[model samples]
Target: MTLTHTSTGVLEFESLRDLLRGYAGSPLGMGRIQHLAPSLDRDWIEQQQQLTNEIREFRRVGGRFEFAGLLDISKLVDEACIAGAALETTQIRDLIMVVDRAAEWREIVMTPPAAMKNWSAVPNISEGIADFTAFLREFRNKIQPDGTLEDRASPELARIRREIDKQKRTIQESLRGYLRRLAEGGTLQDELVTIRGERFVIPVKVEQKRRVPGVVHGSSSSGQTVFVEPIETIEQNNDLVRLLDEEQAEVHRILLEMTRRIGENAEAIRNAADVLAELELQFAKARFAEDYSCVPVSLSPARDAASGAD
Candidate 1:
């Protein structure tokens, strides 16, 4: 028998209508990503809400004066997604795009449902969209139209801002005190320090277990090693932790007190931020409108007597 292999080169011609029929077929039902979409959106929304609160609180606490420029909501969102914070609507679209482009392996390529379920899910474009949306809202309503603040409702704002400055200074001074105490105390006894920069604990090796005779200890995923000593050492370790925990509690108390203080004052921190944001917008608008003059400023046209005399 002659050796022959039949090549099925016949390209089957199915109707184009049939080929395109279920192209948009979804993993779930008519709602498609219904289950995953809301969950992702909620996560994004909650994170955004928390971040907004933190920013507002930071501003209320006088962090705005220290840092230049308002918080970029879009950037924050992008960072959150990159840091595996949450997903956005556009991100789902991107996922779908990738799936569509996979050509042959489209079905095999995992969807958002699978990707989110995985323990090691990474950040994606969804975060960026969420942030962008926030920026849009803030820019349009909270930040843009107000411009410079008039003296009308400023006394309350000014008082709160002054209080924030004072409170921030107190917090800084308190932190310094905590740091000084830690330096004096040496080795945290009761508390856990986040273990920063060098000075990491290591475990004893098996071969050298006799010379370096120690117990098997917990290790960080980054391969940084940890060791556990006797309870005697633990007490010493915990003292610093205890002090730090107390310090943290104190700090929390201080923050609460400061917030309360602001609350006590006529206007809240949000009102103060609104004033500042309005002022910023007004200043920018005024600067844009002002005509350049070498001799005199258009907005504030006062010339010093000494300079005029010269």
Candidate 2:
């Protein structure tokens, strides 16, 4: 049957969409709700009800599922249509998280509890997705949850981080010695060695600026003190900066590698994302039915009659 805004009253559909929105777990599912309409096709409605009934049975058996990393990645995938397209580190990480969740959900579906074993309508959505977990394993250890490559993501990254740490320690030691000397000479304004523009510096009295013999990065509001990066540690600071650059380059290489790997498995990843979204949508409808103690759409005589008349 054909159901339009006029026949159903736009407000009625809007209200139901609003209710569905509350139960939707992800942007994909929530977005689909606005397009929902009553259907008179008995077979399609029965299929939906069968799935919902299976979900209800699973829930009655104390089965539960939680979805994660539901960020809509369709745009990112579409953008990757180019031959050499690259994704940002955060986007790559998000894609990895979605694949990981899909694999986990696939496992749950494959090995349902005793109560769900006989439920024929249970959707095996992850079937035929070839080795999603193994493909994603290439990134599992490389990227951290905060969207930064781990220092141990590769041997080069680990080596660069170690050198950076050593350089930092050397700089800190030199700065501390300078601080001690300045304190002994009564030229120091404060005992703290702070950071300025990514370089370690100490605050010194304006009168003692020449005594410190370093680059004056800035000064206090009253011009009573200057922040100085002592000359003694200048070379060490430069080394540290160089190592930091190397670290950044290494991170970029790792992220690029991840993006490339994603590109290789892009189609499977997109398919997995679609499956998860559909699962989320179906589960959301089941949850809404459970929460409101309402009948499934297929079994609602009033809705069936209204749509059948058209």
Candidate 3:
């Protein structure tokens, strides 16, 4: 039922709403409480009462109902709802958790405990939920927890990364060897392998800079040494950068495909959400009633004051 801002304040409904909201398990559940109001619709009120009573009765008979890991996926789902939208690795990870949590909740609710009775009254929140088992398994296998795709994610990616590793090692070993030669000749400033302008280089004395035969990247603040990228390593550095770019492109491809699959299953997800939200809300109502010592009383017209119904 709708309530004007003025009327709600006068009736002190905010306190009651906050009390109920405290029992919600997640943002989505608390959102339902935010809109909670006194109702005049007899059918809606009775239906809500029946659901809460059902849960409370089951609990009193040694049954438990707790919704764990119920996140508000409305925004994340919206990001995925658009066609051709590629969710980032972290976003996709969060979305995957939704599948797992929803599945866990579904299994527990559908397969009630042996001692549980009158479970027919409990809503089937898992009804029409899509089977995401296969997709979930595939995603886990291809994506690492660090957000990088596994070598087996794609053959091309595997090949590119392997080559990238090889090129990096080659550049490092070559730079270190050159640094050692310079040190032996007394032509080195620090004899250290460092990065200069995104390429491997070694610190050399200004007087020996010509001996190193490379482009100057930068000089030390004191002007005692210069950082240079050895000419021989330029080609290798370029190759490594190219390979890294390729790896990034392949990773994007994988994430885009996963997002598309999520989009395809959006309908089933939305349906499950509707039922789960209602299921969670009812369970919260039952807990609130028990904690507050609330009891359901029948509502009917007063024989003496017919207009009191207003």
Best by TM-score: 2
For 1-310, candidate 2 gives per-residue lDDT tens digits of 7577586675487687788778887776666565667766777677778877888777778988776447778777776555656677788777777788788777877788887777665554456344676786677677777877787689999999999888888888888887887899989899988888878899999998998787999999999999999888888788888888899888877766766677777788888888777677778888888888977542544444566685
Q: How accurate locally, in lDDT, is each candidate?
A: 0.30, 0.77, 0.75
Write down the TM-score of every candidate: 0.28, 0.88, 0.77
Question: Which parts of model 1 have CA positions greater than 4 angstroms off?
Answer: 1-202, 209-216, 220-226, 230-232, 266-274, 291-310
Candidate 2's displacement at residue 187, Å, is 1.4
Model 2 CA deviation exceeding 4 Å by range:
35-37, 80-85, 128-130, 297-310
Candidate 1 RMSD to the real structure: 28.5
Per-residue lDDT value at 13 in model 2: 70
How many backbone clashes are present in model 2?
A: 0
Ranking by lDDT: 2, 3, 1
RMSD of each: 28.5, 3.7, 4.1
Per-residue lDDT over 113-171 for candidate 3, one digit per residue giving the tens place of the 0 to 100 score: 66554465454434645566776776766766676668987788798889988988999
RMSD (CA, angstroms), candidate 3: 4.1
